[model samples]
Structure formats: C-alpha cells, structure tokens
Target: MDIELYHDSKYGNGARVAEEFKRLAETKGSNVNIHHVREAGSKNLPRADLYVFGSPTHFGKATRGIMRFVKKLELPPGTKYAVFGTFSGAAPDKKTGKMPSEEELEKRRRTIPMIDEALRSKEMAKVAEMRFFVKPENLKGPLEDGWQKIVEEFVVAILGK
Candidate 1:
C-alpha cells in the first residue's frame, strides 16, 4: 500500500515523528511519502492508500494548519487513516510502577483527541481507524526506542505487513 504522512509542526515535533513514521512505513517495502505541512502548498495532499497525519497538539486539539488542510481535503474513496502528534510538557505523574515506554510517552506527549474529536465533529466519518502519539522536549525524542513499536504495529495492521 502507498502511504503519505503529511504533518505540521510549528514546534517541529510533528515533522520529527513523521520522519520516523516514514522510516517505519517504508520498512515493509511499501511506498511511503513524508511531507512537512509548513512547506505544503495548498491542500492538494498526495494520493495514498493510507494517510497518517501528524501535527502538534494545540489546546488539546490538532493544529490549525492540519485542521485547515483536512477541511480542504477530500480523500479518494476507500482511503484509510491514522494520526499522531507532538507536545512539550510533563503529563500528570502516574503512580503506577510501570513507566510508559518512550513511544508511549511520545504518544502521550500530548492528547490527540482534540484533533480526532474535531475531525468527527466536522463529519469526518471515513477515517477507518485512529491512533496518536506524543513526545517530549529537545532530546533523543519522544520516539526514543520503544515508541516506534506503537506506530509500527499500527502500520503493520493497516498495511497487512
């Protein structure tokens, strides 16, 4: 399957994670394209069997650029999708003994439902499935080591890898 990961990161985390997603997406020998939303011109998103949108969460929602782009986009019939995002903050400390893995941390780096909720609210019922990720500050990455597994597994299922 062909995939395109279009993302916007005023904070650059979206693009960073998108790159990693691109790498994982291609591992299965599928054709995957990654684009930065900042450099995207117009809503003319690419043709892909699947779309993975990554954006920096804003006020617990997807970024304005992503929202505008999605608003203007009409997926080719039969398109499937997933979403990911990045944020800068410390989540409420959980008292659990298990520390969330790096990717899980990134997945929770920010809440993505704001964007997902808005998508449904805007009548985006075609999204076959949805998943999200969050990352921390300027360091190794929210995608550290274990994080890739979250998205990689999602891709394997979507693409049947």
Candidate 2:
C-alpha cells in the first residue's frame, strides 16, 4: 500500500503525529510519504492508495492553509482519505477553575469535522478519523499522554494490518 500523509502543524503536534503514523505504516510494509502542506501543493499531489491529512485546530477549525489545500484537492471521486487533528482540550476557567463540559467542548472542537466536510464535498471516501488532544494549559503542546499508542492504533486501523 502507498500512503501520502500531509500536515499543517503550527506548533509541531500534528507534525509529530504524522511522523509517527508514517513510521508505523512503513514498518507494516506500506510505502509512506509525508509532507507539510506547504511543501505538497494540491495541484500536484502524489498518487497513493490512501491520503491522510492532519492539522492543528485553530479557533475550533482547521488552519486556513489546510482548509485551502483541502478545498483545492482535485483527486478522483471516491478516493480513499482520512483525517486527524491536534486540539487543545478545554481549559478550566481562570477564576472559577471550572472546566467546560464535554458537550461544550464538542461544539468548540470542529477541526476534524471541517476537514471531513471538505473531503466529503470532493466525493472522497473516508476510512477513519481521529483527534489527539494537546494539553489544555498549553496550546503549543506536547500532546496528551499515550498519543503515540493512539497513532499506532490508527495506523493499524487504516492500513488493516
């Protein structure tokens, strides 16, 4: 299997995930090519069995660069694709120290959903989706614990190994 992984990682969290995904997929006998979105333009994306896109959540949505890249993709209809995102989990209120409810966080976390919409609009088939949490206190993060395991599981799920 051949996989192309692209990421727009402002603070490196998404980049880290993409790197790990590539490493694991390669070990499983898949050919993986990884690129930053800026380096891999939409007009000339390499052909692959699957394309994986990753981005860090910005204001609850994918960064403008990533969104533009997804919008410009011209892959064949029904192309296999997957998405992943790095998000800062809800932080507690400074004064009250009260954390937002899961429901509220859901409303605020639309990074994956935004990418999914763009891919769906292009008629791409989604194989899987995932979100890795950044620590709430720091947006530019060391991702939450066990993120590597999560990425490994994601690679297995997508590669079917």
Best by TM-score: 2
TM-score of every model? 0.67, 0.96
Q: After superposition, how far is residue 114 of candidate 1 from its true place, in Å?
A: 4.5
Report RMSD (Å) for each prediction in the order shown.
5.5, 1.0
lDDT of 2 by residue, 1-161 (tens): 99999889988888889888988898999998888988778987888999999988877788898999999999999999989988986788889999888888877788898999998898999999888998887889989999999998899779888
Clash totals, every prediction: 6, 0
Q: Per-model C-alpha lDDT, please? A: 0.62, 0.89
Residue 37 C-alpha lDDT in model 1: 65
Residue 1 CA displacement from its true place in model 2, Å: 1.0
Mind giving the per-residue lDDT tens digits that candidate 1 earns over 7-92? 88774555656666677767777887887766775456676777777776656466688777666666554456777655544443
Candidate 1 lowest-lDDT run of ten? 132-141
Q: State model 2's lDDT.
A: 0.89
